[model samples]
Target: MQTTPEHDERMAKMTFASVYPHYVSKVERKGRTKEELHAVIFWLTGFDDQALQRLIDEKATFQDFFDQSNLNANAHLITGVICGYRIEEISNPLTQKVRYLDKLVDELAKGRKMEKILRA
Candidate 1:
Protein backbone atom coordinates (compact mmCIF):
# COMPACT_ATOMS: atom_id res chain seq x y z
CA MET A 1 0.00 0.00 0.00
CA GLN A 2 1.26 3.46 -0.90
CA THR A 3 1.36 5.92 2.02
CA THR A 4 0.17 9.41 1.21
CA PRO A 5 1.54 12.62 2.71
CA GLU A 6 -1.87 13.37 4.14
CA HIS A 7 -1.86 10.07 5.99
CA ASP A 8 1.49 10.83 7.53
CA GLU A 9 0.33 14.30 8.55
CA ARG A 10 -2.83 12.89 10.08
CA MET A 11 -0.87 10.38 12.09
CA ALA A 12 1.55 13.06 13.22
CA LYS A 13 -1.29 15.14 14.57
CA MET A 14 -2.15 12.54 17.19
CA THR A 15 -1.12 13.74 20.65
CA PHE A 16 0.57 11.74 23.39
CA ALA A 17 -2.67 11.91 25.39
CA SER A 18 -4.51 10.01 22.68
CA VAL A 19 -1.72 7.46 22.41
CA TYR A 20 -1.19 7.03 26.18
CA PRO A 21 -4.39 7.66 28.09
CA HIS A 22 -3.36 5.98 31.34
CA TYR A 23 -0.11 7.94 31.71
CA VAL A 24 -1.86 11.21 30.88
CA SER A 25 -4.26 10.85 33.79
CA LYS A 26 -1.36 10.08 36.10
CA VAL A 27 0.30 13.35 35.08
CA GLU A 28 -2.84 15.40 35.76
CA ARG A 29 -3.16 13.87 39.23
CA LYS A 30 0.39 15.04 39.98
CA GLY A 31 -0.76 18.71 39.77
CA ARG A 32 1.60 19.81 36.98
CA THR A 33 1.20 23.45 35.98
CA LYS A 34 0.23 24.40 32.44
CA GLU A 35 3.72 25.71 31.68
CA GLU A 36 5.28 22.45 32.76
CA LEU A 37 2.75 20.57 30.62
CA HIS A 38 3.63 22.71 27.63
CA ALA A 39 7.31 22.24 28.27
CA VAL A 40 6.89 18.48 28.15
CA ILE A 41 4.86 18.59 24.94
CA PHE A 42 7.33 20.94 23.33
CA TRP A 43 10.13 18.68 24.41
CA LEU A 44 8.49 15.58 22.97
CA THR A 45 6.91 16.44 19.62
CA GLY A 46 8.10 19.92 18.88
CA PHE A 47 5.48 22.75 18.96
CA ASP A 48 1.92 22.07 17.77
CA ASP A 49 -0.81 24.19 19.32
CA GLN A 50 -3.72 21.93 18.46
CA ALA A 51 -1.91 18.81 19.64
CA LEU A 52 -0.73 20.52 22.82
CA GLN A 53 -4.21 21.81 23.61
CA ARG A 54 -5.67 18.35 23.05
CA LEU A 55 -3.19 16.90 25.49
CA ILE A 56 -4.05 19.62 28.00
CA ASP A 57 -7.77 18.96 27.54
CA GLU A 58 -7.11 15.27 28.03
CA LYS A 59 -5.45 16.17 31.37
CA ALA A 60 -1.84 15.46 30.39
CA THR A 61 0.45 16.00 33.41
CA PHE A 62 4.14 16.87 33.54
CA GLN A 63 5.21 13.30 34.27
CA ASP A 64 3.03 11.95 31.50
CA PHE A 65 4.46 14.34 28.95
CA PHE A 66 7.98 13.71 30.19
CA ASP A 67 7.55 9.97 29.99
CA GLN A 68 6.33 10.20 26.41
CA SER A 69 9.10 12.57 25.36
CA ASN A 70 12.12 10.48 24.40
CA LEU A 71 14.59 12.84 25.98
CA ASN A 72 17.50 10.49 25.37
CA ALA A 73 16.94 10.80 21.65
CA ASN A 74 17.57 14.53 21.91
CA ALA A 75 19.13 15.11 25.30
CA HIS A 76 20.67 18.51 24.62
CA LEU A 77 17.51 19.98 23.12
CA ILE A 78 15.30 18.65 25.89
CA THR A 79 17.69 19.82 28.59
CA GLY A 80 17.85 23.28 27.04
CA VAL A 81 14.08 23.53 26.85
CA ILE A 82 13.48 22.36 30.43
CA CYS A 83 16.24 24.55 31.89
CA GLY A 84 15.05 27.57 29.94
CA TYR A 85 11.48 27.03 31.11
CA ARG A 86 12.45 26.70 34.79
CA ILE A 87 15.25 29.25 34.88
CA GLU A 88 13.31 31.57 37.15
CA GLU A 89 12.40 28.82 39.59
CA ILE A 90 16.05 28.32 40.55
CA SER A 91 16.51 30.13 43.86
CA ASN A 92 20.24 29.77 44.09
CA PRO A 93 22.30 32.15 41.97
CA LEU A 94 25.46 30.05 42.23
CA THR A 95 26.83 29.44 38.77
CA GLN A 96 28.70 26.24 39.62
CA LYS A 97 27.78 23.10 41.57
CA VAL A 98 31.14 23.15 43.34
CA ARG A 99 30.99 26.79 44.39
CA TYR A 100 32.76 26.14 47.67
CA LEU A 101 35.60 24.00 46.32
CA ASP A 102 38.09 26.80 46.88
CA LYS A 103 36.97 27.18 50.47
CA LEU A 104 37.34 23.40 50.99
CA VAL A 105 40.92 23.48 49.72
CA ASP A 106 41.78 26.29 52.17
CA GLU A 107 40.26 24.35 55.08
CA LEU A 108 42.15 21.19 54.05
CA ALA A 109 45.43 23.06 54.35
CA LYS A 110 44.77 23.21 58.10
CA GLY A 111 45.00 19.38 58.32
CA ARG A 112 41.39 18.33 57.59
CA LYS A 113 40.93 14.74 56.36
CA MET A 114 40.67 14.52 52.54
CA GLU A 115 37.28 12.78 52.70
CA LYS A 116 35.91 15.28 55.22
CA ILE A 117 37.28 18.21 53.23
CA LEU A 118 35.83 16.95 49.96
CA ARG A 119 32.44 16.41 51.59
CA ALA A 120 32.27 19.99 52.87
Candidate 2:
Protein backbone atom coordinates (compact mmCIF):
# COMPACT_ATOMS: atom_id res chain seq x y z
CA MET A 1 0.00 0.00 0.00
CA GLN A 2 1.20 3.49 -0.82
CA THR A 3 1.42 5.86 2.15
CA THR A 4 0.85 9.56 1.69
CA PRO A 5 3.49 12.07 2.81
CA GLU A 6 1.06 13.52 5.37
CA HIS A 7 0.59 10.12 6.96
CA ASP A 8 4.33 9.67 7.23
CA GLU A 9 4.71 13.12 8.74
CA ARG A 10 1.99 12.47 11.32
CA MET A 11 3.56 9.18 12.31
CA ALA A 12 6.98 10.71 12.69
CA LYS A 13 5.65 13.56 14.79
CA MET A 14 3.78 11.18 17.06
CA THR A 15 6.86 9.05 17.56
CA PHE A 16 9.02 12.06 18.39
CA ALA A 17 6.56 13.46 20.91
CA SER A 18 6.08 10.10 22.60
CA VAL A 19 9.79 9.42 22.92
CA TYR A 20 10.73 12.99 23.82
CA PRO A 21 8.82 13.04 27.09
CA HIS A 22 10.94 10.36 28.76
CA TYR A 23 14.27 12.04 28.01
CA VAL A 24 13.12 15.54 28.93
CA SER A 25 12.05 14.53 32.39
CA LYS A 26 15.28 12.71 33.14
CA VAL A 27 17.65 15.48 32.06
CA GLU A 28 15.64 18.12 33.86
CA ARG A 29 15.73 16.38 37.23
CA LYS A 30 18.91 14.38 37.55
CA GLY A 31 21.29 16.58 35.64
CA ARG A 32 23.14 18.41 38.44
CA THR A 33 24.49 21.18 36.24
CA LYS A 34 23.26 23.09 33.18
CA GLU A 35 26.05 21.71 31.04
CA GLU A 36 25.34 18.19 32.18
CA LEU A 37 21.68 18.56 31.29
CA HIS A 38 22.49 20.17 27.96
CA ALA A 39 25.06 17.51 27.15
CA VAL A 40 22.65 14.67 27.81
CA ILE A 41 19.86 16.33 25.86
CA PHE A 42 22.20 17.23 23.05
CA TRP A 43 23.36 13.65 22.88
CA LEU A 44 19.78 12.42 22.86
CA THR A 45 17.65 14.88 20.85
CA GLY A 46 19.91 17.57 19.43
CA PHE A 47 18.74 20.91 20.91
CA ASP A 48 15.16 22.14 21.02
CA ASP A 49 14.15 24.79 23.52
CA GLN A 50 10.52 23.73 23.84
CA ALA A 51 11.47 20.11 24.32
CA LEU A 52 14.17 21.05 26.79
CA GLN A 53 11.74 23.17 28.78
CA ARG A 54 9.29 20.29 28.87
CA LEU A 55 12.03 18.05 30.20
CA ILE A 56 12.91 20.61 32.84
CA ASP A 57 9.31 20.72 34.02
CA GLU A 58 9.25 16.93 34.28
CA LYS A 59 12.77 16.37 35.66
CA ALA A 60 14.89 13.49 34.33
CA THR A 61 17.69 11.00 34.99
CA PHE A 62 20.53 9.85 32.75
CA GLN A 63 19.01 6.41 32.22
CA ASP A 64 15.59 7.92 31.78
CA PHE A 65 16.86 10.38 29.23
CA PHE A 66 18.63 7.60 27.36
CA ASP A 67 15.58 5.39 27.42
CA GLN A 68 13.36 8.09 25.95
CA SER A 69 15.74 9.47 23.34
CA ASN A 70 15.32 8.92 19.60
CA LEU A 71 18.30 6.57 19.53
CA ASN A 72 17.58 3.23 17.89
CA ALA A 73 16.82 0.44 20.36
CA ASN A 74 18.98 -2.10 18.58
CA ALA A 75 21.82 0.39 18.36
CA HIS A 76 21.49 1.15 22.05
CA LEU A 77 21.50 -2.55 22.81
CA ILE A 78 24.59 -3.10 20.71
CA THR A 79 26.30 -0.15 22.36
CA GLY A 80 25.34 -1.46 25.79
CA VAL A 81 26.86 -4.81 24.94
CA ILE A 82 30.05 -3.17 23.76
CA CYS A 83 30.17 -0.92 26.82
CA GLY A 84 29.82 -3.96 29.06
CA TYR A 85 32.68 -5.62 27.28
CA ARG A 86 34.83 -2.50 27.56
CA ILE A 87 34.01 -2.12 31.25
CA GLU A 88 34.95 -5.74 31.85
CA GLU A 89 38.14 -5.28 29.86
CA ILE A 90 39.13 -2.27 31.92
CA SER A 91 37.73 -3.20 35.28
CA ASN A 92 40.57 -2.21 37.52
CA PRO A 93 40.82 0.37 40.27
CA LEU A 94 44.09 1.72 38.89
CA THR A 95 42.73 2.02 35.37
CA GLN A 96 39.54 3.60 36.63
CA LYS A 97 41.55 6.43 38.14
CA VAL A 98 43.06 7.36 34.77
CA ARG A 99 40.59 10.09 33.87
CA TYR A 100 42.28 11.32 30.71
CA LEU A 101 42.46 9.58 27.32
CA ASP A 102 46.15 10.49 27.04
CA LYS A 103 46.87 8.82 30.38
CA LEU A 104 45.15 5.70 29.12
CA VAL A 105 47.28 5.77 25.96
CA ASP A 106 50.43 6.29 27.99
CA GLU A 107 49.56 3.34 30.19
CA LEU A 108 49.00 1.25 27.09
CA ALA A 109 52.46 2.19 25.82
CA LYS A 110 54.18 0.73 28.89
CA GLY A 111 54.69 -2.68 27.19
CA ARG A 112 52.39 -4.32 29.73
CA LYS A 113 49.76 -6.98 29.04
CA MET A 114 46.09 -6.01 29.07
CA GLU A 115 45.56 -7.46 32.50
CA LYS A 116 48.67 -5.84 33.92
CA ILE A 117 47.95 -2.48 32.33
CA LEU A 118 44.37 -2.47 33.57
CA ARG A 119 45.53 -3.41 37.03
CA ALA A 120 48.12 -0.65 37.12
Candidate 1's C-alpha lDDT?
0.38
Q: TM-scores of the models, in the given order?
A: 0.27, 0.25
* CA RMSD of all predictions: 18.6, 16.1
Task: Quote the positional error of residue 58 for candidate 2 in Å.
Answer: 0.7
User: What would you estimate as the lDDT of candidate 2?
Assistant: 0.36
**lDDT of each structure?**
0.38, 0.36
Off by over 4 Å in 2: 1-40, 72-120
* Residues 11-88 of candidate 2: C-alpha lDDT, one tens digit per residue: 333333354444345434543333443443343344466666665566543334334555422222111112123322
Worst 10 residues of 2 by lDDT: 74-83
Candidate 1 regions with alpha-carbon error over 4 angstroms? 1-17, 51-73, 76-120
